[model samples]
Target: MVTLDWTATEIALSLGISPVGCAEISGYKTWVNVANEGLADAVDVGRRQQPSLEAIRKLQPDLILTSRYRHASIARALGEIAPVHLIDDQENEDDMLASVYQSAHQAGAALSRSDDVARLLESFDGEIEKLRTGHAGQVEGRKLVVAQPLPGVPRLRAFAPNAAISGLLRKIGFADGSQMSAQPFGFATVDLEGLASLENDSTLFILGEAIPDDLLHASLWPMLPIVAQGNVRLTGIPSWPFGSTASLKHLARQIVTRFV
Candidate 1:
């Protein structure tokens, strides 16, 4: 089998299928765990922007997994090689966790591993319960702002109330501190001043990388309540904020690991 989408590859691997071919970008360190375990012997299909059609044909995979958002246009061409299972993310766009599970179930069904999907979700639930128990006091009635600091850029990518990360944070017991109006993509650009406007008790979840030193020492930085209270949590774990089950699981684990 071959996976043209990174999220699909993650689900496939969680279901115990080692794809014969995978898109190159899916092998990044953000997905290191899955790549090392499931893609150790997979063929790289070149860059996602310009995947090698010839390489795919050489693999002769029985199935090609893709997503409607990224691969709908290529579905026809990819179908010529094998059956293309397009994972539609927009159907459950408003509910990211549901969309993730739906995508996982789709992959599991295709791979005849629905049982594995169920088990994975069960484990995720258990882990979440543990995290909720462990951080019961810190998160109760508390709000948080989950943002991605764009390296070299002065602005931050703040997760809107509709974002997947925001949804997860709310589920784990923190309220959304972004307080921004909802958008289709579930994110808004904000500067330090914008962040400062949020409630002081609101913690911060900075995803992907740490705040650059210049920003850390900025005159405005010390003024933020989170910074003053030492509530700024940095998660250097590379992850797709809008990713699938495995990525979500990885994120949940990172949160638990950091707090514990």
Candidate 2:
């Protein structure tokens, strides 16, 4: 049986292959509700950033699959115990696609279900293309404000060219604010007083792990006119707003159907 770290765990779930055990990451208990419940019996390898090697060793997995984004060195360390596949997410869309496809195949091999990955990718191909075609002229040259929410952190991240969220943004023809590209800032702290500094036509899109309850609970909801104006878009995926290719496909489809 394979022991999956959070990234692999997400892909495994997407590919419909459940691992024998997995690392319990910050986002899983909250965001990946279905996968967490379905794999309740699986052993938790601890947090994704700091996995419990002692516990991982106890699971005795045949292969250890961890993502490279937040844990490249950790994957190397885990390799000493078992065959580790440390994938780099630094590449472009084609590179990411390769990684996802290869990771799916590797996951299938580990679970002895190689065909599942191919079928899943095939099923998604048509949907992805349709979205691209549909949104071709609709979203052309629109401005977007991708905001990241952090309760205490002073900075918020916006979309970038290499970022997964930005990848979808580009396809949809959404142009990010230059400031959003240079630096990230919080939404709550950035009211109209701050937004007044930017162009008026910039559309708003919110992305984060979990926004503070205060944003909704307090008087802040009505105070933020951009959101009140129905321009705020929430990304369901935790990482990069749209972290994975699977999610990228979702955004493409949604943009074509709704935004465009």
Candidate 3:
């Protein structure tokens, strides 16, 4: 099958089914550099915004899976090549994990691997339980804030309670540490000043890249408790936040490695 959604590709990879082709295969550092380590044979169909129809025509996949959030606009055109399946991420907006679970089921049914998806989900649950029990004391009353600094912008995109990352953090026993209110779409833009308002006991989980070198010397940087106490942690994995059970387990393992 052809995959336009990174999350779908991750799910397929987790199930040990290598896709025929994928979009933006060589562009992303995490997806190419880290995520695609063992699976190097999938063809690069093209970029996400403008997938090459000619390249897709050569493969003639049985079906095409596209993300409603990212590839809805091209669904009509893609349908001409093969049947298009849409992963509706917006269906269960309030519960990110459930949304991912449903997506896994959808993909599994489409791929005729429902049993494999079930086993993967069961493994994910088991892994989460192990972390929850092992770190029960360490994370009981702890608070964490997940943030990714916007490129070329002097602001951080804070993941709110509604975000998939925030839900995963909560699953591991961390409370939402941001002072700002949750947004419908699960993100809020906060400058350094706004980040300073989090609780002193709160830890910060930085994603994508390290805190900018220049930000380290800023006058306000040292004022944050998480910074002063060295509670700030970075997730080095280049996985998508809006992903399946496999992604959650990958993220949970990262957190356990850093904090447990």
Please name the candidate that would achieve the greatest TM-score relative to the true structure: 3
Overall local distance difference test of candidate 1: 0.75
Candidate 1 vs 2: which has more TM-score: 1
Worst 10 residues of 2 by lDDT: 180-189
Clashes of 3: 0
Name the regions of candidate 3 deviating beyond 4 angstroms: 27-29, 32-38, 237-239
Candidate 3 lDDT score relative to the true structure: 0.75
The residue-by-residue lDDT of candidate 3 on 1-260, one tens digit each, is: 88877777777778888779888776533643335653587888888767898898899999888677777888888899999888765566676667777888888888889999999888887888888888988786688887776776556778788787777778878788866565766778887788778888888887754776545757888877778988788888554565667666776677667776
**Quick one: RMSD of model 3?**
2.2
Better of 2 and 3 by TM-score: 3
Can you write out model 1's per-residue Cα lDDT over 37-90, one digit (the tens) per residue? 667789999866567889999999999987777888888899999999888654
User: TM-scores across all candidates?
Assistant: 0.88, 0.69, 0.90
Local accuracy of candidate 2 as per-residue lDDT tens digits, 104-177: 56656665566876786676666665665667676667676666665654334444444455545665556654
How would you order the candidates by lDDT, starting with the best?
3, 1, 2
